[model samples]
Target: MFQRPGKNEYLESQERYVSLVPAEGDLLTILKEQTAEMHSLLGGLTEEQGNYRYAPEKWSIKGVIGHLTDNDRIMSYRMLCFARGEQAPLPGYDENDYAAAGEFDRFTLKEMVEHYGIVRQSTLALMASFKEDAWTGRENSMTRK
Candidate 1:
C-alpha cells in the first residue's frame, strides 16, 4: 500500500535500512518528517558547537551537516534517474573528498541546514511528480557490490 522499495530494490548492504523501516507510513511522509526534525535540530545549534570536531581529522559539525545535505542531494539524483528509467550506469562519489572540498567551516550552521531543507523540498516535489510505476520502478545501482 506504501512505496517501500521491494526486495533487491537496493543493494544487499542496504538491507539494514529496509529492515529497520517501519511499515506505518509512506516514503514521502517519512522523508518530510525526518527533514523537518533535522531542520529544527540544526536551527538551534550554536556556531561554537559547529566548529568542534571529535578529532583533528574528523569533520566539524558544520562539515557533518554539509555532508548530510550533499548525500541527500546525491541520493535524490539517483532516485530521480531510476524513477525515470535511466539505463546508463551512474558514477559514484568519494564522500570523504566531497566533505573536505565543501569547506563548510566557512559557513554557519543555519546556512547548511537551510540548504538541506531546500534540497529536501525539491526532492519532495520530484517525488510528487512521479507516476505510479516510478514509485515501484527497479534499477541497478552501479555502486552495488
Candidate 2:
C-alpha cells in the first residue's frame, strides 16, 4: 500500500525535489532566462559532435538533447496536472530506453538543436502563462516523488 508523506517529510522532500519553482515576482523572467540558456547551450553544437557518443553504449549528444526535450514535455504535463489539482500518480519513464529508441546518432547537431529550441519555446510559453496559484501548486509527479 502507498502512504502519503507526513508534513515534515513532505516539506523536507520538497526542498530537495522541486526544480525551477520561481519566486512570486520573477516566474516569467526566470522561465524566459532558463529557456534562453537551454537554447544557447544546445544551439552551438556541430553534426559530428551530436553523433559522437562518450562511450560505445552511451547516448550521443543528440540523444541527450532529445531526452531533455522529452523531460521538458513531461514536466509541462505534470505542471498542468498539478495546477488542475489532479491526484492521479503520473507514470515514470525509462530514460535509457527512450534514449536508445531515439536513434539520435542519425541526426545532425544543428537539426537536433533546432528541434530542442522549438520544444523549449513551447514549454516556456506554457510556464509563463501560469497564474501564481498554479505555479505554486503541488502534485505527486514521478520526478518529484
- Best candidate per lDDT, number? 1
List per-prediction Cα lDDT, in the order shown. Answer: 0.79, 0.68
Over all chains combined, what TM-score does candidate 1 have? 0.87
The clash tally of candidate 1 reads: 0
Residue 48's lDDT within candidate 1 is 91
Question: What's the lDDT of the predicted structure labeled candidate 1?
Answer: 0.79
Global Cα lDDT for candidate 2? 0.68
**The best candidate in terms of TM-score:** 1
Clashes of each: 0, 0
Cα miss at 86, model 1 (Å)? 0.8
lDDT of 2 by residue, 19-131 (tens): 33532335456666877887787677667766778898888888888898888788788767766777777777888887777776677787777777787788778876777
Stretches of model 1 off by over 4 angstroms after superposition: 1-3, 139-145
